[model samples]
Each structure stands twice: as C-alpha cells, then as structure tokens.
Target chain A: MNSPLFFLSYFVLSALVLVTAMAAVSFRNLVHCGLSLAFAFLALGAFYILLGAEFLGFVQILVYVGAVAVLIMFVILLAKPGVEERRWGWRDLVGRFAGVGVSLAVFLALLISVFRSPSLAVKAPEAPVFSIAVLGEKLVTEYVLPLQATGLLLTVAVLAAVIFASQEVTKK
Target chain B: MLEDKSIYPDLREGRRVVRPGGKREAKPLNFPARRPWLTLGLAGAAGVFGALVGVAVLLFLMEWLKPGFLGEGCFLYAALADLDRAPAILLNGFLAYIASFVPVPPILLGILSALIVIGVLIGVFLSLFALTSVVERKVLARIQNRYGPNRVGPCGLLQPVADGVKMLVKEDIVPAGADRVVHFFAPVVMLVPALLVLAILPYGPGLVPMELSVGILFFFAMGATTEVAVFMAGWGSTNKYSLLGAMRAIAQMISYELPLIVSAVAVVMLAGSLSPEKIVETQAGYWAGIVPAWFVFTPWGFAGFLLFFIAAQAESNRSPFDLPEGESELVAGHLTEYSGFKYATFFIAEYVGLFAISGLAVTLFLGGWYAPSPLLAFIPGYIWFFVKLYSLVLLAIWIRGTVPRVRIDQLMEFAWKFLIPMSFVVVVAAAVWHYSGGGFLGWVVCTPLLLVPYLLFGSAFAKKFAPSGRVYRYSQG
Candidate 1:
C-alpha cells in the first residue's frame, strides 16, 4: 500500500519515536530525561509533517519543544534531585511491575482498536489540500464555540496561577 | 649503536645539550611556512569551478530534461521551454537516449535538484559568513581608528581560512565530569536551527526554497529551539558558570522573543499572509513610480521596524544585549567550556542566526530582494538582497563597537517595560494606519499615537535611572 519513500520514512520515524520515548524514561539525570522527552516530541512533530498536517506539525514543535520542554527543564532545575542512595525494597519492585503491566495492557488495547478501525481499508486521496487558510476558516466558522470555551478556560487557569504566585510572594 | 636524533638525551652523552650550566641562544624551529597565495588561488579556482558546475547543471536540467521526458509534469518545464542553445540541444539529444530507460525520472531529478540547491546555498552562505567576519573586524577597527588583521592575503581577506585551519588543528577537550554525548550534540543542535531558517528566506524573484503557508511561524519556531541548544551546552558542561550563562541567555531570548514576534505581527497583520514572498508582494507598488512603497515608508511601519530591529538584536545575542557571552563576567557564558571546532561551530551559528534574522527583517519591512526604485531594476534582485542584508550586518557591527553591554536587569526591563509595550502600540498603530487607508490623515493620527508613548517612556526611563537632586549632598563643592 505504501510507496518506497513513504514506507521508509514511516519506518524510520516510528523507530525514532520508540527510541526517544524509551530514552525519556530510562535516563537517571532529570535534564537528560527532559531533553529525551523533547526529542520524542520532535519525532511526533515529524510524524505530523509526514502525514501532511503541516500546520499541526509546526504547532506541535512550537508548543511542545519550544515552550513545554523549556518549562519542564526549568522545573527540573528548580526542584533539584539531591544526591542520595536508593533504598530498594519489595514494595518498589512490585510498584514497577504494576506500572509495566498497566502500560502493556494499554498498548494491547490501542493495538486492538487500531486493527478494528474500518478507516484503514479506505484509500486516502493522492493529494489533499488542507491549507492553513482552510484550517483557519474551519476553526473560526465551524468550531468557534469550542474555541472560545477553550480560550475562556485557559484565561481562568492563567489568572489562578498568577493569584497563587502573588500569594506566595505576599507570604514571604 | 645508532640513536634517533629526535630522542637524543643527556644521560647517554653524560652532559645535557643546552644545559643550565651552558650558555646558548635559543633558535627558532625550522617549521614549514604557510603559502597564503597558493591556498588562496586554489580556493578561488575551486569557487569558480563550483559556480560554473552549478550553472551548467541548472542549465542542463532546464533545457535538456523539460520537454519530452517531463511531458508537462515538471512545473519549471513550461517556464523554461523556450531555452534552446546549441550546446543544450546537443546535450538534450544525448540525454534523451538515457532518459528513455529510467522509470519515474522526475522523482530522481527532483531529489537531485533539491540536493544541488541546498549544497549551493550552504556554500554561498558559509563563504559569506567568512567575508562578514573580516568585514566586521575591519569596520570595527576603522571606527576605533586602528588597523585590523592586515597581514594575511591582501588586507586579511584570508583570515577566516587561517582561523578555520587553526580551529580544525586544535585539540578537542571535554571535561571529565561532563555528559560527553550532550556536550558534543550541543554545537550540532545550535548550528542546525540557524541554517534551517535560511531555507524559507526568499532571496530573489521566484527564489523561495520551501515556502510553507506558515512561513513566519516556521522561522520563529526554528529560532525558538536555539535556546534549548544554549541550555544543553550550559547544562552538559557540568560547570556552574556555563549553567548561569545558559540561564541568562534563555531569559534574554524569551523576553526579547515576545517583542520580536509582536513587531512582526504588525507586518503579518498588514500583509495578511505569513509567507515571506507574499509579504514582499504586498509592499510592491511605487508612489507615482518614484518612491518605492516599502513598508518602512509608513508611520506605523517605521515604529514596528525600530522595535523589530532592537528586539532582533537581542534575539540574535548581538550587543548591547550580549550578556550571555559577557567575557568580563561569565567567562564566555554558555561557550566557556567549548574548545576547538566546537567553539567555532557556536560562533558560525551565531553569525548565521544574525544573517537569517536580518533577512527576515528585510523581507518583512524592507521589501525583500526588491530594488529601492524601479530605475535600479537592472541590477538584478539577489544582488539587491545581499546589499541590503550586508548594510544591516554592518549596522549591527557598528552597534557592537559603539555601545556597551547592558546590565541583565536593565536588559530585561528594557525588553518587557519598554519594547513589549511599545510593540503593542506599534501594532495598534499599524491597524489604525491600515484602516484609515494610509493617507495624510492616517499619518497625522498615527504619528502622535506612536510619539507620545515613546517620549513618555524615554523620559520616565531617564528619571528612574538618572541621579536625583539630593544625591551627593555631603560632597564638597
């Protein structure tokens, strides 16, 4: 079903996604883990680009890699993980195993849903015209209500953050 | 027994050569001297060859492959269909035989063309970067009433080559405590975004490489990642100074980025499209075929241009906003731990970033790649682009030479309290000017709207910082 170049790109991107995701969780250093997470986000953006979601791809990078990743690193630096020896126990081991089991179950469910989807049988258009102008029109006209609601929600959240921060400053 | 002269030791002879007891004048080692002319000539020859080869390939692609094999599928084929030279026709006749056997030749041709374009662009800019460094040094020297680097190849033109060789030959060192992988990756990461933004910048008419619908957004998005690389460099070094420098750099970048984007928003608002090419097109018409109708001619555009210029200076870490690399305080800042070619890579990235930002500014406000007037159209578009670009670069160098670096607090205050607020005003001004149809009445309304805040801010800034009347009361007259 796939052309040679497209198939190659898909394979490479999926491999990158897996590797970066693994690296994100596996690194001991918080900064390293954060950078790894950023890489994973970048790979996801590349995936979006390959899927012809150009605007979505750029937004993915601009929001996640540019803003969120920087915020993650900042938080990690602020809350320094002190040098301490790990106190391993059966409780910790059991917790780890439980986490792995839950993740595996989720993965299996996702796979099942993907396999069951009817859309996979349908052929996509040879070339799709989903320009930024079309997306903008759709957002404003078709989905204006949801967009405004989301905007209101975000504004309130920001106001709450500012209030909390100001309160801490006043307390000191 | 014969002993190697290189390893001759005092113990074998029972007396040391040039010992403390003996008096001997130290002589210069017979090292091989550099042949500057030879190297320069070779480089010149290579450059000429490269240019000739690039032209030949483009000509071959345009004239030879377009008509029969492409069969109108290739977009450029129709545009170039009229080009039929004797050599080109002969080449096409020969190439047609080979073209018959290839399946989907357009795909292969497209990839090859893309590679060639990218290669040529990189070569051009890299050489331009070398020239810019020399030009900056010479200009700064002239400003300070001194000569700069006049020893190498006719007024130090070959200095970049020499510096490049030195950087290459130097030993690369990484601190024992450093994260080696990230440390190495940092320079690479830093260099990439600087070059990536260059791809979208339209240099001449029909010269855009990859024109995204969200072109400006893509440029800024790439620009944003350079801060991450700065952090990586600082954090990976395992040095506290590096970390501090990185923090300062990120803070500066983040603060200035707001105003930079906002000022650009004014242009984006006026143009009604994000594409650099479209932005340039919007600024196309001339006033009675005399004064070019560039955005900079407008009152709001003037304000936006000024704001964009200052913010861009900070964004690219040019002085008086270069606290990130403040040598007096932070020991080269985020670049403290870098050595050899890694350090050179950071420098290259910095200059490239500067060029890209300057290019964007030109595209947004200065009517990118367009000649100043219709009379100057014969000069060609790309030449006009570089002339404007280098003039901005020279201005940056002049600013670097004349102004002292600002304090970190003052820098932040200037960006947030001054530039950001003023940028918003500029946007409002742009909107006002646009709605009013940009006539005399629009200019009259917008000028005061811009000037009042600017004047107020300037006076307030001066009042806040300048010495008070009661200051130094105890000092004897």
Candidate 2:
C-alpha cells in the first residue's frame, strides 16, 4: 500500500498537469502557450517520479521542458512581432469545430479502451530496481534493435534539419 | 537619483549626451590619515571568534551533550560514514520529542527531515554564494592594482552584506510594457536550476545531498532549464536589447554545453559510473604512491579537462565568452530590464552556477576531495575539494581579467568549429587509451590521434583569427 504522502503528491502533480495543460491551449500569447506547455511537461515528469520512474522523470524535464520548450520559445521570440490574433472566417470556424469534435471522439475512445482493459483490475507488482545500469544493460541486450532504430531516426532527423537549414532546394 | 528616465533617457532614442562637468578634483588636501589595518584586524579577530564558537557548538553536541535523545550508535555511525548528519540528527531529535506527545507518520518524518536538510543546505550555500561575489571582486581588483570596497568593513569583507542591503532597498522597476508575471517568475526560475545542480555535487565523502544513481545526468538535466529561464526573461522584458541579449546568452550556453557534456563523457566512460562519488572514488589510488590518480593526468583526460574548462567558461558566461552581457555591446542582455533585488538574484544565480560547474569539473577531472599526494592526507578531502574548486574559480577570475571578450561570431565558431570537434577527438582518444590500457604503446598511438587534429584546427583557427603583424606608415621616429 502506498503512503498518503504519495497520493497527496500525485494529486498535486496531476492538478499541475491539468492546469498547465489548459493554460497551454487557452493562452493567447504564443510564448505563454509554449511556457505553459513546458510546465505541463514538467508536471508530467513529476508524475513519472510518483510512478517510480525517477530517471524518466528527470529526462522528461531535461529534454522537453529544457530543450524542446526553449526551442519553441526561441522560434516564438524570433517570429515577427504583432502576429498575435487573426480574424476568423467561416472556414476557420468550421476547422475549429472539426478539431474539437475529433479530440472529443479520441478522448471517448481512449476512455472506453482503458475501462475495457482486463489488466486494469490487477494490482501492480513490486517495482524492479530499474536503475540506470539495468536500463543500459537491457537497452544493449534485449532492446538493441529498437535502440538502433531510434539512433537511425535521430540521424534522419538531423539530416532533415541540415537540409532545411541550408535551404538549397534542388529545382528538380 | 531615483529618476528612471534620467538614467537612460537617450538609450531608446539611439543618441549619446555628454554632460560638461568640472574636471576630477585632486585628492583632498586636508584628508585625514585612515587606519584600515585596525579595521582589518578587528574583522579577522571577529571571524576567528565566530569560527571557534561554531567549532565549540559542534564539539558540545557531538561529545559533551551527545544527546541520549539521539538513537544509540547514531552519532558514531554518521561520523564513520563522514556524512553531514548534523542537521538531520538535530531535526530527528527535535521531531522525536514532538512525536512523543503526538503520533507522526513515517512519511511525514521523512519529508520533514528532507525539508530541514534542504533548508540548511540553502542557507549555507547562499551565504557561500554571497561571499564568492565579494571574493571575485576583491581578487579582480587586486589583479588590477586597486583596493576594492575597502569602505565596507575592513578590506570589503562585509561588502556582500552592504550590496545585499543596497539591492533590497533600491527601487524595483518594471517596464510598462513588460509581461509582469513572466518577468517576476524569470529570476525565480533562474535561481532554481542553479540550486538544483548543487544537490548533485559531492562535497566530500558521504556528504552528497542527494546521491542519485545518475548524479551527473541530473546535474546537466537541471542545467537545461537555465536557457528556458533566460529565454523567458528576454521575451518577457519586451525590450529589443534584452531579447537580443537573451538570445545571445541562450545560444552561447547551448553551444558551449555540448563540449562541456562531451568532455565529461570521457570521465564517465572511464569511471564506469554516472555518480559523482563513484567517479571520484575511481580516481583515488596513486600511480607510484605519490602521484594521485586524478583524471587530469591521463592524456585524453588532460584534453577533456581543457575542453570542459573552456566550454564551462562560455556556459557560465565568464569573460572572453561573456558576449551575453557585453556591457559595451548588449547593455546587460536579458538582464537589461531587471533592477534591484531582481538583478541581484540573477547575479547570485550566475555566481552559484559558476561554483557549481567548477565543482563539477573538480569532481570529474581533478581528484575531487582527494589530496594531491598521499603524504598530504592529513588535510581532509572536503578541504582539498574546496581548495581545488576555489583555485579553478580564481583561474576563471584570472582569465576574465586577462582576456578580452570574444565577438559573438567568434564565440560560435570556437564552440562548433573547434571545441566540439576536439571533444569528439578526446572521446576517441579516451576509448583508444582505455582499450590499450593506457600503456606506452597507447600513448604512441593516441597522442597523434589527439594532436594532429588539434594542430590542423589550431592552425586554421589561428590563420583566420590571429592578427597579422602591423606596419606603421608615416611615422617620423
């Protein structure tokens, strides 16, 4: 059984996640949206710690809140000022409605799947050590192919970034 | 004096005004003879007295009043491990007394203990951070053949206190157009990462605040938030200068942090652990019972240390790489809009960051808390750690004094075109050395592997940046 402190922290972090997520979507300023999104990510990271994934939690904070969010803010700051709000047309209104409809449908589907899962009734087993050493060993041995695939993906992403940055579009 | 417009009225207008004023007055003809030595002596005596009182309290608690309140063998066990258990033990005893009257959950006790430990650490290190600023200023002033802050209590020993008071009492300004919430949060965000990184540093044996299995990764992970904080400050300020400064500062930090992390990878690879204490422990033995097995001595490690040091300078925004706050150029960068205690908070963050990174360097490349030689083992490891750490800090100050700030373009070039490539070579060299067991043949193979690239890159860099000899024309000597 978990301690009440654990539940209290979980509730606090979940509250942070919900609030920041809402703020991220609803904030008017693009920079504020990005920052709120970063806060959401940070809260999620804290949630990971509550789930007994300390490394994953810190990595989330390091990568998403630190790098990705900073990069988003960089682009936001670099974009031309006074590009805030735009007038909405009929197409835009329709698009907004469609987006909301799609998201609601997806949420309902996810809810059904979670409730329907047989595994949901089972209690969690005691967590493994899951230390960095164990993680590294597993990655190299059992999950080596996935690790290589991730590396490949990262390389391809870097190549794409280089191509986009250089901007020498071949007129083929 | 508090007129905001008067301070920088023309800055926004892109104009400079020269006020005609009387020439500097000669030294006062009727100046009284001042006895600075008396004040200095008194300050020294007071410091010694304070230290003695602290020691006496520690002794009284540990020996004379070994509180029966403390569990049996608690003191001996904590002392044997060399952990800083004073705060925790004291808190436990206090809490136990409370728990005798009222029930306390184990979780609550644990949480309260952690809180007390963190509180004590923050109090102690914040004082150290303040002292570092005063130390840096004094050292820089001495290097420039000037007395610094002598008016503030005996050789400026009390200067940080005065500075803190000034920062607190000064007006806190916010530009009308600034994002008030984000601006308020920026300094707080900035301070958090600096403090967080301090948690991972192993001050001495068993003295780590939090010994995460991935301590070094934790340090860098916390470090990543600094750029985001910088960006927030810049964007929130609504000033072009602040935005530009923030961008430059963030870019510099991102750039330099690459080599900094990569260089430490060599140490991590060799130590086979990410924990700072483990890394230090691996470097404990002696080569010939004289030379301590510090990573700095290995060829690859030597290169990595140099790379880490240089990149750290940029990351910390110390001079030569201090283009972010280039006073003559960017008007204090992201800090342009900050004033008073807000600015002082940023100042504290920078110094704290400097100390943290340098302390990391010590843990990685230097012998950490280990004495340099076995013969000098009488001095404690924590003392040795601080000695090496402050020496690096002084070296940073010296470099700041000696070198001119590099241009932004040059700074970027140095990180990407030079340091990053060199770091890769150093990593390769470490691998080679490791595989070869770092014997004589390994040196033969790895030295050129490391140096050839260095020579080529150094020549290319020198050719581009080094000034050609100047010839004077129309000189009538």
Off by over 4 Å in 1: A82-85, A117-120, A140-149, A159-169, B1-104, B467-477
**How much is B35 displaced in model 2, in angstroms?**
7.9
Q: How well is candidate 2 docked (DockQ)?
A: 0.69
Query: Residues B343-410, candidate 2, lDDT per residue (tens digit)?
Result: 88888898889889999999999988888987887676778888898899889989987888888888
Tens digits of lDDT, candidate 1, B136-217: 7778767877655554565568778877897889899999999899999999999999999999998877677787778898
Task: Tell me the TM-score of each prediction against the true structure.
Answer: 0.83, 0.87
- TM-scores of chain A across candidates: 0.88, 0.87
Candidate 1 lDDT for residue B123 = 89
Q: How close is candidate 1 to the true structure, as a TM-score?
A: 0.83
Candidate 2, B-chain TM: 0.84
TM-score of 2: 0.87
Name the lDDT value of residue B179 in candidate 1: 86
